[model samples]
Target: MLVSLEIERVEPLADGAPFGAVGAYERVVGKAKGEVDPAAPGNRGIALIDKAPRNASGKVEYTTDIFILRPKDFSRGNGRILYEVNNRGRKMLFGYIADGPQGVNDPKTMADVGNGFPLRQGYTIVWSGWDPDAPRANMGLGLTAPVATDSGRPIVQKVRDEFVSGTRGGALETFKLSCEAASLEQPRARLTMRERAGDEPRELPLNQWSFVDARSIKLRDGSKPRPGWIYEFHYEATNPKVLGLGFAATRDVVSWLRYDAAALAVTGGPISHALAIGFSQAGRYLRNHISEGFNRDEQGRKVFDGIHSHIAGVGRIFFNTPFGQPARTGTQHEDHFFPENAFPFSTAMQSDPLTGKSGSLFRGDGSDPKLIETNTSTEYWQKGASLLHTDPLGTTDVTLPDHSRVYMIAGTQHGGRAGATTDAGPNVNPRNPHNPMPAVRALLMALDAWVVSGQAPPASRVPTLADGTLVEADRTGFPAVPGAAVVKVTNQVAPPGDWVNPTPPAKAYRTLVCKVDADGNEAAGIRLPDIAVPLATYTGWNEYKPPYPAGELADRDGSCLPFAVDAAARQAAGDPRPAIAERYKSGADYQARVEAVVASLLADRLLLPEDAERYRERAAKEPRVAP
Candidate 1:
């Protein structure tokens, strides 16, 4: 339970400016102190919890950085709470939901609030650090967790670390380890380099590289590692943290605020319901949290009423284990051996014929909360997102539980950055800049209604085998555009235990992706105006340029290949996709088409009004359809 909350500071938010009907808000910054009984049923499942140091009451103690924003006048505030699990200790809620600028981890000004969507809705915005090893830069929030020991002695374990230099200027002269090395002895560690994940590693001579310190290593002769090369390090490390406590910490913090009267002092008003939204790694954390049964608090109460798991695909965090690394994510071209993608990829129950293990993300207990699983196109290409709704073999679609909904934000990349140009790092084609935030804003409101008032959300929107919109990667029917690379590979899924083995089973789950239209745009999911009235062929996959390994997926990036300007340009470029001039009669015509799609989406409750206007405004200035 949350033992105490140490308030560090409290101040007016955005200079005390009123936000629509929500009135002026205040920010509360503090540290949340909590503990869990190792012998308790709620805590025993935590890895190495029993080995952690205990307090006077025989409880393992922990502290987490907490930040909250709510109305100054408590009675005027919404009784709902929105908690965003920090991604690498930085708060991303404002950037995605509020359309706020990035790198504003510490929001104190009106500009930091962007359009003020959340504040206007009167939500008590909450963020508490759940990652123990989350970086401290950029005012990052992190948890202070206890390390596990064996009978008062340090527990030692072997840890693996991987690094890659994807750019020409990127060279590794020195490398840092997540965990401190137990010894500086060269023989105590093994280092190897490979050009690709599937290639055989070449062991570096001991004389070529030496340990710079217990926590770092350097090349002796000033040798810089080659770009696109994967460096693997295996070393002995001591002190494994009770990382699973992070789940309990989050549960107790939310539970205490909802159940304990002392929470009134923090929230200003009582919080009747809570919702959680996470992106990428944090999103996968939510999956692990629910599957591991952390949704049920120590007192047997549900924690979050609703959850928005975004862009996580069919992955879970490599958390809650001995020497777990929460920062590592498994992608096609990187971090391949991590335990991020494995069995039980779906919330539905299905058996992995290879592993002989059968289970679902939900525990089937009454503690299960309403769930909304959303993903971007990059997830289908690089993270095996189809598994979330498909069977283990990817041959058939599985039905989601009544309380769950899935939506695929079509024609976008992993991080939906705004703007039309693709200036992604180390990618051959322009990266996809088709932001899907507008659709997300609408979905969040729908999720709130589902949890707060038992209102059903919009039906799930995703490509399915039954509809013939989901197909194998090779059969996506992607256009043969000039200089464009078709997806030849997708992330393979193996049993959960295969992550730790040197060689996983050669047999793997079948990979699938959303089919595309004649224009090379995704044919399914929530299509925004940018996709509906397209000027480019946006895709979920981008190829790595030279220096980096060719033919491999450019780490979680998507491609945006714009069509030719006119018929002459189209014929000259041999572009099969119709030219912008040929598709639309005039710029005004294109704007009308975009507005029509936006209006339809709004009627279906898939697009917010403010966001719909933003789309229309952008369409008016679209240069591709200019007269």
Candidate 2:
């Protein structure tokens, strides 16, 4: 294996504070190894993967980018390394409060480093580019790979491309992901119109569209497609990038930082322990990394001591493919099906009753590290978070390993906002004000303590079918709130397949959703102090309007409807639920309720003392309840 690291550039970050600011560096890691096959099962990704023929050196060559954020003085830093897996070239896990658009380790300026939380924590942070398509400016990184081919001829393959119109327009302009043009100008095109997930799909004829350029497609009659309609084009695209190498590249980099003493010297001493944190797309990547056994390096040593997977749900990314689009996280209405949601859905090793394939994410080889997996209420309705705990057949619950804990942040959307009230998000749905980051921060501290002091983290708390909290989606007892889009909360799964010609063994497996109480709050999962002491009805599902179906859960958004200020308002609406005033004698009483919830969580080891006071302050400042 030709695994090597080179420092490209180094600069000071964050004005060189007490830890003397942060020392940021640009790096390139290249590996020379035997040729790899993209079709092999576990071999889907291995080491620093290469798709092209080995050079005269008799080794395949591949290079990928990485950005390291360390203390100027290594002694001033926490000996731990936090490898943040980037989602489409953006660094997550820091959970920063940025001044504007910010990339976590993006060089040039860590100026407005959003509260600089990570900096204060003293952990060395690292970001690397595994996606080849990522741009270069603003600290964007990428991997370099050769096009896969057979002999001297180009290897032709079928590819699937899904197009969703972001804006309403007369003509929709489409572009290819990895390839330049279609091998045959007109391949096979299919268009479908659907207002929502369960709505009947109306297919448009192939003759209605044609290719404008190698990548661009246009309507044949000079007309435009509907804004919410989904368009799929399976064309003969050439020069498919060896996208599978991305997973391998990421594995090698993390491995190098963990074990390579020389590489570790640059950041002070060797990493005594390492933790990986990813949200959404990046979260899925972390799941695949362990599920595929990428955690065991070439030397057969574990890479991370723990991983924090936030909002990933049960789906691993469709990251390995001929022309992989690492950024695409398919929703129900758009990009219907691809390889994003595949088998081995749960962390435990189990037999797929349908496919007869048996595998587990852990090796039991003493390399399976501890894990803290957190999700929001949105995941149950959208990304199939329930499936992670449930069996493939959704018959029984799957027992989690002792080292792993799964918590669902009740009544919040994916990556919720801070200090938000009943407000509309940038998406089509109104935003749920519930923020999971505070709970996330506390859990992370628990994870760190567990790793360092051999202390056990908090118990896993999530909705379960055994308990009435986890129930069928349609059975959630939601209260009547005007304009609340409380639709059937079920998983929308499709058959996993090849980009173009997919031969999935099954269409969709059993789906489960969490049960909500009369106030529309999820009954299962970790209830934050705010959730336990409620003001508004925080929910995990929202809806889209017109062109899109109304009651369908809006993509990754949630809803928040403030309760009636008094019993008169509740009676006026004919709503049976008691109003906020009826529950709490005064605003001070509400603050005490919030305090009790926080104290309970703190005693249970789920909330830190520092965070307890923070939550208390948060409740005290709630604008909705203020006089």
Candidate 3:
């Protein structure tokens, strides 16, 4: 396990800038080499591990990219490690949690680290590659894994690929396949197109497209791919990497750092506790890691003491199968039928009536870590988030274990961007830009305390059917706003299906959503100031434009529909909601209301003091009502 770590480069972070009392920090960039025993108890569950090529010692070898930032003087810093799972090989913890700049994969300057929140808190930030197919653009991190073979011979299998073009993608002439084609002449290959997920797929003539090479396909000159249309391809492929080794590699890396004193040479100090945080696609990886029992190292020691999964909803990653594409995920208007949504959605043990399977995310052993699951409103509408708290049949709420806490950050989109105003992409309405980072920052600190000192964090903040806040998707009680469409359809959850050759589900599982007030805002959840105080009617669902399917939910987008400026404007528009002027006497009145809500949130430990001040400053600048 973690046999060697080769340091490639080391440099002072931000040109030796001091971050509070922790002093200057150093960034270590290197490659981590590890080997796993297929016959070992902890590694046996990894798919295709036995089929992978082995070293001289009969152990499977793997190499992964590693990046870490730690205090130069380890004794003065917190003795904890904060590991952030990168999304698509790119890091986002700084931007999402520290209010830092977005899309900086390689950070060097002060601006790159944003406000340096993690450094000031004396955290040893760590990142490692876990996906073999992760993109290498922009210095993206990834693992180099061995392909599964049978007795020195290649293994071939049929794989399926799904692709959906964007609004401006109609001019696109070529699409890349996830796996290489076995031969140039593919007689068994079939290409089908569908208008929507429920519609029947129409087979396209073979003459319409031709294989550009073993790895990509190009459409004929006359045939242009339509936007928002689903395209499916089936072909024979070979050379499937042992992707499941990613789990073992992650476990081994963390285990070596915690139990091995030699790790201090890399970590800059001894790490007593390790916390893992993942966002979006990476978040789903954590669920799979826990469910697959990777938390227990080979030596029976815990790898991570705490886990924070954000925006993953009730799904696990499709990463442990043959020819698996870890980058693909199921969404409403795209990637509709993947193996992400499986049984045992909740943390507590439960039974799936369809498959007759009874289990939970936890292995029921003592290897479970303290879990903090955070989701945005978009997950409830597009990702089957209700199943995380409700039973499989959507009948009643399931109580979470003492070690787990779930919170729903309302009125935000999946990519919680702050200060979003204009409509972008194919959506008809303005996209939701309400930042949920303030709550995220606070919860991260709370999770660290719980793991370090055995202190319980805040109580779970989620809507429940017992309180009448969670109901059927159609019963959200939305107001009839002009030029706005209400959401009645959500992502369907069905029984697990075969990944390579999947068939249609005979029946579907019931899904629910969060109830909303008359103003079309979510009534229950961790309501930020933008939601607690009225500024606009924010919703987790947004409709696609005309070119796309009608009434279908846009992929992971939310809407922000502002209220009328005055009563006259509201009456003229036939809007039932109160006007801004009628709700507040003046601009100052609105700011006061926002301030009060922020103070309450701070007292509840749902917001940090720095974020509270940011909210006040933003509220004072936005004066929708007359002074």
Candidate 4:
């Protein structure tokens, strides 16, 4: 039977003594010559050294002059000596003695230098071997003391005790025996910082950092005198708004080596130095401070054009969003995804006549009016183009002609929900309900394989409709909306009577109106509208028209009197119901709202009818799951 074997010194022999040394000669004699004497009782299987006694050295030592003798007996029924005893024992003994000094004595000297047999100080030699047939046999013969201090303890402990430590026996030994033994050389690390010609002021907090090295490496043949291993270090400022974050890279060292004549020790290598510079800035700066565009001469022109030009062919572009942008349909909101902006406002407001107004009154009409209808031909769309143009930033013109991979993680909050971002507060989403990290990792692995093996990645890892399960890479683009369910209303609007001023003096007025499907189902694709009521007195009103004049009875002076329901007002309406008594009942209101919006979109041809119908059916049968 084949078996495995392992051996270790559970309890090291004391007094620096070697293991199995005492019985070495006795075993050798037993194996070479079966028995020393046949007439002696109980000595049939015994060897000569078994009867030897310890000398003054307190240990058994085989004498160099010891020899083996074979008996001569008569043959062929005649008592005659077969042959005179030959002097072969002395001749064999001579060869053993001649080889002993070099083999045995030299090994003993090396052992003493390495700290008596496999251990010295606190360092112990550890090794492993296997013999298929003799599983239980000794397999611990290959262990040796560390190359550096064959007689000393680990350097780390020595350093802790206020003594200088050497790397010769630790990392160097392990590196040489493992990595270097295969003829692999450690690649020199290189760092390239993106900066302009002049010095730029920046600061990088060491605490918030990530070090990314080659996950797997392949060396190129005939590349250079010293080929470098590619690595990337990504560091984001804890304060997300702080731009111009800088970074510095250097080799990680344990302790410094000192040169001293008394010790006569050779230092391992020179300490690695660093290149420090800033890659980003809090605000935009020109390529040259004194360049043509220095004096605010190009305020209306694109701010990112120069930066994009400078970084054209340097390296791959990385898109980083410290705080995720609010979910929107198109790229109009992309520029606001960066940290420079504190809050999101519609681009239409940029050209508002009263643009300088404070508080929430900065946008739209001054009346805090909802559903204010305005023509799209105004400057609103133009402002959107300007703001949106800044989004691609330095990467606007960059084309990955090499077919470099692009990984877009769906349903992920910016900068990770828990990392170094201003949004990392307790109230933030604890976990991304839609897990996308797994998918991102799979994509990265695929890219790695593609780059290394010349294998093209699959057109899509996403599952077909017939496939039964979702894989990591399958969840690539966007998260599927959760099943439609009840929506919970945390905030409620007051009824007309409860309002500071009631219109038409009605007993029960509909303060909030929620439009549902003709079937009155609260599933997906149900529509909602603003609160509609009979006017106390109508000056003039039209469903498709706006800016209708209020009649004489309109309470224009009071806070709640001049209120009129409009399209914008319907879209911005808040929930007007109390919390459910049970926790499960809370999501009812939101479910109703989402269904209503989806229904409207379908009606307006914004969504495909088939898609709308499917979602509606799903929402009706089961609750919508949140992405």
The whole-model C-alpha lDDT of candidate 4 against the native structure comes to 0.18
Q: What is the lDDT of residue 623 in candidate 2?
A: 67
Please give, for residues 401-428, the per-residue lDDT of candidate 2 as tens digits: 8888889999888867564556564234
**RMSD of model 2 against the true structure:** 3.9
Ranking 3 against 4 by TM-score, winner: 3
TM-score per candidate, in order? 0.97, 0.89, 0.97, 0.17
Which pairs in model 1 have colliding backbones? 422-431
- The residue-by-residue lDDT of candidate 1 on 71-160, one tens digit each, is 998777778899999898999888877878887888999999888898999999998988888987767889999989999999988888
Q: What is the per-residue lDDT of model 4 for residues 457-512, given as tens digits with 9 covering 90 to 100?
A: 33321111223221111122211112211211101111112111112222210111
Name the TM-score of candidate 1: 0.97
Per-model CA lDDT versus the true structure: 0.86, 0.69, 0.86, 0.18
Off by over 4 Å in 2: 1-3, 19-51, 95-111, 167-178, 187-213, 218-225, 419-429, 494-507
lDDT of 2 at 41: 43
Better of 2 and 3 by lDDT: 3
Error of 4 at 247 (Å): 9.2
- For candidate 4, what is the TM-score? 0.17
| Candidate 3 Cα deviation (angstroms), residue 128 | 0.6
Tens digits of per-residue lDDT for model 3, 1-627: 899988899899999999999999999999999999999998988888989999999999999999999898898789899998888899988888877888899988898888888889999998999999888677688999999988779888988898878732344567888887887785678888998877888888888888999888877876778878888898998888999999988898888888898898999878999999999998999999899999999989899999999999987887888888888878777777788989888898888888899988888788899999999998988888888888888898998889999999988888785545557567778778788888988898889989999889988888889999988888988899998867788888888777666777887777788899889899998999888987788888888886777677888888888899888999999999999888888778888998999989998889989889988998788757677
